[model samples]
Target chain A: MNTLVLTRNDLSVIVQAFGRDALMDEVLAQLRIALREYDPSRTQSLRRQGFVYEKPRLGVLEWMPVMRVSRQVVIKVVAYNPGNPDDVGLPTIVSTISVYDPATGHLVALLDGILLTALRTGAASAVATQILARPGSSIVGIIGCGAQAVTQLHALSRVMQIQEVLFFDTDPSAVASFPRRTAFLGLSMKSAPPNVVARASDVLCTATSVEVGKGPVFEDSDLKPWIHVNAVGSDLPGKIEVPLSLLKRSLVCPDFLEQALIEGESQQLDASEVGPSLSDLVKRQQDFEAYRSRPTVFDSTGYALEDMVATEIVLKHARALGLGRELAIENILADPRNPYGPLDVQASRPAQDRALP
Target chain B: MNTLVLTRNDLSVIVQAFGRDALMDEVLAQLRIALREYDPSRTQSLRRQGFVYEKPRLGVLEWMPVMRVSRQVVIKVVAYNPGNPDDVGLPTIVSTISVYDPATGHLVALLDGILLTALRTGAASAVATQILARPGSSIVGIIGCGAQAVTQLHALSRVMQIQEVLFFDTDPSAVASFPRRTAFLGLSMKSAPPNVVARASDVLCTATSVEVGKGPVFEDSDLKPWIHVNAVGSDLPGKIEVPLSLLKRSLVCPDFLEQALIEGESQQLDASEVGPSLSDLVKRQQDFEAYRSRPTVFDSTGYALEDMVATEIVLKHARALGLGRELAIENILADPRNPYGPLDVQASRPAQDRALP
Candidate 1:
């Protein structure tokens, strides 16, 4: 069987074909469908997550998260090697996605997961902003001007009137470069400190690239009431981007409740502190503005549904354009009864050659 | 940057180049190293198993089992579609093996897991037989004669001296065709019922193709004293091939304790009743003849390391011969800082074409 191999360049082309607005619209629609078909009781059977291995005893660990959404089966294998950038000039987070045919257990596509991850995550934050942020939200503050920062602006712009964006990064170079990188969006930008961004924005998005046990970007005193926070970067155990004091006083909505309780910023607080998840929010449309008296947190630990949707988007576009290269990775046996028939043919080749000689 | 895609033809050739004895030897050596590197305390972190998705509401669910052995990470995706054979003429169990480089999170190879699974599983049973069975065992009895049946005999022959063989299957045609298919092995064969085969053999292997909750092939009364039973078929939550009474009477050894407890025949009995795992057996030197008075059951639910080792064997032979094709699936970015540079090129190409027009 043939498997479509979509490289990073291919995905980039696909994402560009459909602009950020259309891509976010497709992702949001897929997320809705994902939530509608999801049975909360089957969550246990739906996904599995674990640390695969640790290199050098105490160094970074590779994590594998596998999940199935309806007919789509996805396994995202990512390595969180802290030393990759310094050692090999590769990104700290490297991932490969395997998409399978659930009916036949055949791998239909192998995707570059690093870019897909960023887009899906940005879209998830956009979804949360659409559902949880107060009406007419305009000004947006973004902390951590890294790879994810551009996507966050691109996605959030599709959902909200992002007329002005404030960028804050500890690295002065990152702060200096954010404006030029995002200049194509035609949105005015200002470089501000963390506290200034926190106090002056209608919505706050934290996508900091911090090590485990890093300091919180801002204290509880800095956050403004009614300003929604998309805590996108704290996705592993011991990784905190938001303070516990702020989370305790806010209506925290997780992307997926179980995952956020473990890997999201809500991991720091008690279970009771976290409110309904994004799935729950999509399932039951609540008057989100009623609970906007305090800061809201969409604890954005990336979900498998978002990845599957983004992958489906890429696969659909690739197949439509006939763009991806076909790899003969899987074998289709002619006869099931003689599974070893191929091996016998190889084993007998030498005898045949010798006989001919 | 390049992943070697090994098709069934490639794997068949590789396995033939290595032969059964060398293949089994390599698998056994890898098993030993796997057990040595395995920390019983870290069992929870080393392996993750879960159902991927279910079709037709409650029908067969695709299962994914992932594990890490040192720097190598492997994920085996198996789809168990009950309606496959009649509906689509496909095997009930369709599997694919994905091997990744943990350090770089790069996929090194994608091997056809269907054949690899059979070979690895058969090798696992053979490894257990070599460790647990009596030294002078000769006669072999196989309960089922399907796809796995051939490999069981092939793997066992490499580890033991089989002067005579007995085959038993409910399907008369399967029983009739076993000898001709395995005629290369040049072993005397006997067609017998399950009870007769159970009572007469020194090594009794139950590789039956039975549905979940089906009747057991044989009971405790049918077992010969000191006969080692390689229970290789039952590997799901509700599936059973061996009688619990027989399991209760035998010293059951699981391939992996936690997995066997969930998917092996041990699922029928309490966790306390299951004896030492095969890893434990491989880790320690045990006196086999001392415990030969009672029946021994090697509960093989299949482990990820076996697949990795078997893949490594295939990969080593394939790489040495340069037999597999490379797929350009992932792109290594020239500048890590400019993650979106590829998209910019795609976006600018259209504008450049427009300017020329």
Candidate 2:
């Protein structure tokens, strides 16, 4: 059997062929179904396992695995190097995702994970915002205008009637380029200070790469009463973007509770203080309608289930468009009992005289 | 940067260029150095994490990750399906190994892991046999003549002056094809019952695919007093190959103590009954020389360190021969700050008019 290999270019073709808005809509709909129907007995997603190193540069390499019982297994191998952009002209994160057949253990497909990760994260936040944000929420605030900010705005635009965007960043160039990068969304964009962005918005997103222990990106005093915040930047132990004081007053729901406590904004609060999980909110949206009148937070640390959903979307599009190469990467041996069968075939040895090096 | 991709065919070319015996010697030498110089502070090899499923078929998919502080990280994703050979004519285990750069998280190379896994397991046992087996041991016994037995006999031939081979398996075809598959080694081969193979041997290797909770592949009374057994097949809970009575009387050294205690022959013995680790034996060979006078067990459940060493050898050979293909699998964006830069380039959009789907 051959494994389908998709490159970054192929993924771009997929996104362009199927309009971005349409793809986001499909992802949002699928994610809602996956979250609403999640059964602990059928789906298994373990916390990521990897190493955090401090030499050569500060970085982490992690493996996130999620298995759908009797169906398939999807795993993403990601590397986060904080110094990649300035030092080596590379993105801060790089990753690859692989899908395997549960019964045969055959690799079905391998896809580039850079764009998939960003898109799925954006969709996850959109799901949260749809359930927790006020129905009339229109003005969106974005802090730390980096790569993630583009998808955050795009995915929210798909779910909400976003009219204007207020954004801020410490880097002048990033603030200047934000409008051009997301001009396709056709929304009014303004570059403002952090406090101004926080206070004049119905919803806010914090996606900064702030140093550990350096933040709660904006103070709680500078926020509106019904603002829904998608806390996207606090993925490391001491790195937080939303203030603990703000989380205490708000109804904080985490994407994955156990993982969020270790690395997300929920790390600031005790387990008892946190609200229901995103899955719970997804299952029972009507039960939490009262939270739309107060402050709310969706703490996302990125889950493997989102990756699995995104992979399904990408592979479906790739298959329809025939946009990847099929390679015989594994040895599907002619004789299953002998691993040396391939070597013997290569040397053209007779069965009785077969020899391995 | 491009990632070098090696398929099964490319790996076959590499093995044919450098003789298998020469390669095993190199692997054995590097493994000894890596084990002797291993320091917990510099190297981190976590226990593997994955899922074990029993629907459609009984199988497991696991990820083994090991890091050499500040240098590199090697990860192996393996799938073990016991029913593959009979149901689909595929090998029982299929896997792929990936190497990542620590500084940039760039995937340096991806290689086929089927043959590499077998070679490394056999070489690990050879390292143990050289340390614990009696020097004049010329007779070798192999229980369960499957794919692993070929490499087991070949690797032992490189380390010992073996004159005869006695092997047995429940499957008659496996027993019939053993000598032809190992024709290169040119050793005397005989097929016998389990007790006979266990009795007339100086060193025994048990690599059976025994069912869970139905083990002790051979009886304790049918063995030599000073024989060293390389227990290779007991990698899951409730699955053991060597009898508990034999393990109680032997000096049992595990390849990795923590992992062995969970899935290897060491699972049958208490923590207090286990001897020093393989790394300990490699570091202080003279201190454990007395083990050669009694029965010893090398509980080999496999480790990531062996895979790391084997990958280094294969890559060195591939580079020297200028083999394998290089593909640009990742998106190294022209503008590091913008994830949509590639899409803009693909669509020929000017920088100011850049838009993502």
Which number leads on lDDT?
A: 2
Clashing pairs in 2: none
Tens-digit per-residue lDDT, A1-357, candidate 2: 887888777877887777666677778788889999999789999888678888888788888899999998999888877778778988777878889887877788887777777788889999999999988999999998877788899889877888889999988978988888787677899999888999988999998888888898888886888999999876688889998898999999998898899989999999999999899999999999999989999998889999999999989999999888787776667777676664553333222322323
* Runs in model 2 lying further than 4 Å from the true structure: A342-357, B342-357
TM-score of chain A of each: 0.87, 0.94
Clashes (backbone N, CA, C under 3 Å), per candidate, total: 0, 0
- Candidates' DockQ values? 0.33, 0.41
Per-residue lDDT of candidate 1, residues A113-209 (tens digit): 7767767888888888888887888999999886678778877876777778987988786787777667656788998889888887788899876
Classified by CAPRI criteria, candidate 1 counts as acceptable
* RMSD of every prediction: 4.4, 3.5
**Model 1 clashing residue pairs (backbone):** none
Q: What is the TM-score of chain B in candidate 1?
A: 0.87
- CAPRI category for model 2: acceptable
What's candidate 1's i-RMS value? 6.5
Per-residue alpha-carbon lDDT of candidate 1 for residues B1-357, written as tens digits (9 for 90 to 100): 677877767766766776644665676667667765677444322343545345542234343344453566676776666445445655556677777666766677777777777778787888888877878889899998766777788778777888899989887867887887676566889998888888888888888767677858876675677889999886567777788887888889988778788778888889999988887777774645455667889998777767777777778888998887776555456544334544453332221221100
